[model samples]
Target: MFIRIVKMGFNPENIDAFLENFEANKAKIRNFEGCQFLELYRDKNNTNQFFTYSYWEDEEALENYRNSNLFKGLWANTKLYFNQKPEAWSVNKIAEAQNKKPAL
Candidate 1:
């Protein structure tokens, strides 16, 4: 799977507006083609900083979303609330530990 992480820093006064925009668009983002998972996180010490963690089937899926009108509209609204430029990363999982015990 391909993973995407985006970190955004919002102006304290504009945080609510950012949240409202995100809330309105999150479902559409999650339901987009090849999207496997979607989640949001906030910095422990900075309430105005947030991160989005999502999983896609592959890079092409991610690119398709980025090229879509949904992203264009959401990002246009979202960028207005940013305190600084957003940071993003695309990654691949190398390893993961299993939670369940194997058959003995």
Candidate 2:
């Protein structure tokens, strides 16, 4: 599985507008092919700072979604509110939780 995380810092006044866009499009994003999971998070100390954490089947699936019109629209709306460039990370899960379980 591929894990994708994007952290965005927005102007405090624009936070609600950005979240509205996310709420409106989150369902459609989650329904994309090869999408495993999706969620939005906020920094506890800074409400204007938010993040999205998603899981995908692979890089190809992510690329397809990134190139879709849905992404373009959502991203365009989100970017204008940003106070700084977004930070993103793509990761691979190298270990399973079950492997750390105590032996029977």
- Supply candidate 2's per-residue lDDT for 44: 94
Q: Local error of candidate 1 at 101, Å? A: 7.5
Write the residue-wise lDDT of candidate 2 on 34-84 in tens digits.
Answer: 899999999998888899999999999999999999998889889999999
lDDT of each: 0.93, 0.93
Predicted candidate 1 versus true structure: per-residue lDDT over 4-97, tens digit per residue: 9999999999988888888888899999998999998989999999999999999999999999999999989899999989999998899999
Model 1 vs. true fold: TM: 0.91
- RMSD values for the candidates in order, in angstroms, are 2.0, 2.5
